[model samples]
Target: MSIHVVLVHPEIHWNTGNAGRTCLATGATLHLIEPLGFSLDEAQVKRAGLDYWEHVDVRVWPSWEAFEAELPRLGQPYFFSTKATQLFWDAPLAPVEGTVLVFGRETGGLPAELHERYADRFVSLPILSERVRSLNLSTTVAIAVYEVLRQQR
Candidate 1:
């Protein structure tokens, strides 16, 4: 059983590092689609990941097209976005192979094209406060991935 966490066009290294830590904890593979905002060697990133960076099974993609081309080999990917009408809990997150959870940039949710293409797979975490825009990227990934672990166990 494996869970795959994908961060597309991620802008913040700290979030990415933190997400990696979550992936490490959950036995999930971490895939990063590039044009990254910060270097992986940055001190802050290392700080966030701490001693666990070496343990993370991380893969880097050159672009969205490159990553999308390899999607078939990866497995069933679900897009997480604030715009989605479906709630994350509604998804059948069975502990299965090639289960990819894709998240977008911090400020912007996901590319409109992806949203349009995989609209049915998109799910959102409910935000109780009207003033908040969205949850932290790492926090979202942790929550979503854990849900998969919960269901599988």
Candidate 2:
């Protein structure tokens, strides 16, 4: 199953650029929901290199509501959160299948209610540092997305 990466209210350009590259490497679809932090053409993003950008498969959704409406209709499964009890390493992921791996903004992460609602589907990458609150946005997505691919394989 292909992993879909969703970023809600993303606020950085380089992070988005790195994420797109990761998706390209992993064969995942990158989805960005507005409002975004930088103009899509920001120069900082250009640093990630044009080659990866060319191969990156990305989808833009106008709003969160629009994404929610389309996700189920398209039969794409999703996992949301960084601190979820379920570990991504253990979650059932498949190769060549269509599933989604959703992430929130780097600043605050997902809303409490959204976390509660998707609790079952949520999967987290284990952190050795309780002192370290979270991971880099792109880093987290890369880790989780690959785990999904690993499981599926």
lDDT of 1 by residue, 1-153 (tens): 678899998998878888999999889999999988878774755665567888899999999999999887877888999999999898886635568899999988789999999999999999999999899999999999989888887
Worst 10 residues of 1 by lDDT: 41-50
Residue 118 of model 1 has an lDDT of: 96
lDDT of 2 by residue, 1-153 (tens): 457889998888778888898898888889899888877663545654555676778888999889988887444455656668887777665535477778888898876877777778887778888798878998988887877776766
Superposed on all Cα atoms, model 2 deviates from the true structure by an RMSD in Å of 2.3
Model 2 has an lDDT value of 0.77
Any runs in candidate 2 off by more than 4 Å, and if so which?
Answer: 42-51, 73-76, 95-97
Residue-level error in angstroms, candidate 1, position 6: 0.3
Best by TM-score: 1
**TM-score for every candidate vs. truth?**
0.92, 0.86
lDDT of 1: 0.88
